[model samples]
Target: MGRNTRKRRSPLATKVIAGAAALAVGGGGLVWANFYASAHESGPSHNRTRSAGAQVATIQCPDVGQKLRKVPRGARAGVDRELAQLDKQITEAYARLASTRQAQSGDASYVQNAILGPLKSKRTAALDRIGTNIRRVGGNTPQGLGRFAECRGMGVDQPDDGNGNAGNGQDGQNGDGQGEDDGQGQNGGQGQDGGQNQGDNGNGAAGPFAEDFVDINDVQPGSRDLENGFAANGEGGSQGSFTAVCGVNENNLFNSDNLIVAPGVDNGAHHTHDYVGNQDNDAFSSDEDLANAETSCQNQGDRSTYYWPVLRLQDGTQEFDAGDLGGGAEGNVGKILKASEAEIKFVGNQRSDVVAMPKFLRIITGDAKAFTNGVANANSSFSCTGFEDRQVTDKYVLCPEGSQVVRTSNFQSCWDGQNIDSANHRDHVAFVQQDGSCPNGFQAIPQLQVRLVYDVPAPTVENGQVQNPYAVDGFPEQLHKPITDHNDFINVMDENLMNEVVDCINSGEDCQ
Candidate 1:
């Protein structure tokens, strides 16, 4: 997509309300301002007060190392069944909770007491049962069975407080009828001016969706020109542009069941992913593992693992409705809904014979946390088809009538050429020049751009015309507001396909 063709909108507006409850001391007529403000502010204040009933409990995982035991061969089926049951239970519980909230018109106490409270208890019991089954099946490790169970209590009852606490206030406070403090340091008795600030939490924390790392303001528009070996007259039949399609990675929900960060130690991507390509790709999978595994890619040799967060329709059949299931709990309400579209493409490269990407090279692009933080770039584009002028950076993009909402992520495409991986999963890879060439000391690689098209239902679209954005699962409530989204990929390409890709880039020919 051309950046110039789209019209950009300013960041969302943040409204802060300031109120001061005054008290007159004795007969002297001295005044004191119990001033409370809600604008995005920085630093800390000693005057902050939280309600007693609003505290949320935190859950931590047990420490476990790599090399945890996999499910025993004979017990695999049973383990799968048990896990699936737990998944169904949790999904249904959330669905019921969602319904109750709607029925109560979002009465916080009713939702918490009648819905979430009971659901939490049921989930806890379900998790305990799953844990018992895991031990019986010989998958006995903190990272293995325990990790999956750990996810059962992974959420907070109250919404996120800008300062990392769990509270009910919109900007940050417990839901109880209590005053909110902006946490900004006190300037005697004066109140700070409130205004709309982009990508900043009221407490000076980076908004959940902010992309502070990349300076989007400095990114030059993408170009097709190849640098490095090209002559002024354009030698070697260079086309100045190239595009290739990586085969669609179907919703392979269970191939590499392990996760990154803590291989073998944890269940892969605590929230699931729609995986494609390599069969053996996982946190523990080595180059040899990928080399031996079968693949779904058209090029049997391409074993790269491509994946991203799953998208769901807001009001689809997957939505939670009362009595959908036999029990009081609904089935799969807040669960993973089937994706309508999953397409991955390689769009930018200056050269034809790019070098093969190193094995086990991990690259994460975009910030998943963007839903909570504001994006660093105004160009983190979000728009519905046909409504090109109303581009936004919010985590959720509400499409207009007769329009399909889409999210396009353009990843950096310059490789350091020497290191297969880096400590941060970035560093080794860099963005190509605006002219579509590799930077100094960095070799050109195909730019990975992924686009996800969503089919949200009518209720998800506000007023049946404007889009009603929602956040990806597992993000903060604030994230449900319009914000940024991101994706991750690991290089498990077959050596042969990698060579072919390089040859195509260096030869200046575009091929799928």
Candidate 2:
């Protein structure tokens, strides 16, 4: 595909152009550059008027998975499989949309008829099956799921946070709707021939637009508080920490499988993920499979799995998966950047003591479709080593010389104390509140924070264009936005190791 600059749209066609999307890999909440024309806009009125005729860049579909939260256990496998199908349907539709730009330019309703219309039909069926699956087990089915079948055509510059508001009135970041599943799962069996051309979208343009980046110096020293009330100098409260050594994927263990979110479905993620910790993970891995699998962690007692989307530089390098399903074939192109460091830490709550997480406790922190879903669960933190105080959740940091890209995420630390998994995948755990206290009745668990550092060259913004943009792999509909960064984890830690973590945090001792 060619990388030509897009021509301006005609005013009359503004009525025809429509919507865009994200679900970055991680357990990395997906973050896209959400446009708040009112707050982010600069320059003359002519520029604003010129932008009125925006071209439809991608399709935005309602994340049905985020809505179904109480599926019965008996119906989960069936429901999950159907949800996976929904993701697959959207991927195919996006591929069609990406590959049909020329035809779209000539026909006002080409996208509606050629891509979105058929997509709705497929989604409607899958949603229907979801209801049937739940009802069969005497569970209450989600209502009005059929309403999500219709996907809108989102424009290149228009950033809608699923609501009418653009940018959520908070510098283009606001609210949380549990977001997408960071597009977990990959069909290790699929072809790696870059079967789909997501990079150029058949229009010869790379993504992240020039809007997804901002120089770190320009980002205000953010007020993000990292201190969770641990004793400063041998003080009280749970002050201990457990740092698990999970190498930065020294073993080329890469996949798109997300057992927690979309079990039994192959190639479910549709985007590549770099995995560490549990070595045996895929769409079909059972709890037993994970517990028995090899581990990347130094402690053999921990078989936990940690995975997130791989970061890539848009420097025209095709990785080995370039032609495979989750790689360049799905629009995740470029050279994969290995983490200079992948640090996994488990810390305690400042307000209360920690408890052992149930075996197989599954957690997915951050939202994958936050670009389209809004900031509700947006938890990805991007910063530079020296500029750690200035972290941004929606935009990737354009670090200065001597600085490197850093991605950090704090998984939900408050567990419901009963179920290990929830229907929306979020009901089981809650984030610690501003006061570092868990919600009422929710027990505090060792908060897991995964930090990844990269030495990729910093992207430079010249004349409002990014020269070397780098981003996490994400769903095609959700443009590779930094806000879409997310991460996933499954606790396969043995009972003894789990107890040790709890004791370490409770005893105020930093342990291995």
Q: Which candidate wins on lDDT?
A: 2
Each model's Cα RMSD: 15.7, 10.7
How many clashing pairs per prediction, in order?
A: 27, 50
- CA lDDT, every model vs. true structure: 0.39, 0.69
Give the alpha carbon lDDT tens digit for every residue of 1-512 in model 1: 01000112122121000011111212111111111222321222111232222211112121111112344444434444444344344443333332221233324354345544554465556556645655775665334333333321112212332343433233332221122222322111112323211212111111122221112222233321222221221242233233333444453333213333324422223233456676665545656776787776777667676765544332222222111121001111133344455566553354433556777676666543332222332123455555534444432443446666666666666788787654334567776554556779997676666666666542321111121123343222222223335566777766776666666656656666
lDDT of 2 at 304: 97
Candidate with maximal TM-score: 2
lDDT of 2 at 34: 24
Which stretches of candidate 1 lie above 4 Å from their native place? 1-258, 316-341, 350-354, 371-381, 386-391, 433-440, 458-470, 475-484
For model 1, the run of ten residues with the poorest summed lDDT? 14-23
- How would you encode candidate 2's per-residue C-alpha lDDT over 1-512 as one tens digit per residue? 11001222123212111122232332022122222111122332111221221234556777888888788999999998998888878777766665554455456566677787888889989988999999999988777878988876554443455555654112211111111111212111111222222232211232665567767777677555444322122344478999999898888877766778888776677777888888888877889888888898999999998999989887666466554556655667777898999999998887788899999999998887787676666788889988877877777887888889899988888899998999889998997776677889898899898889999798765444456578888877777878889999999999999999999999989998
Name the Cα RMSD for model 2: 10.7
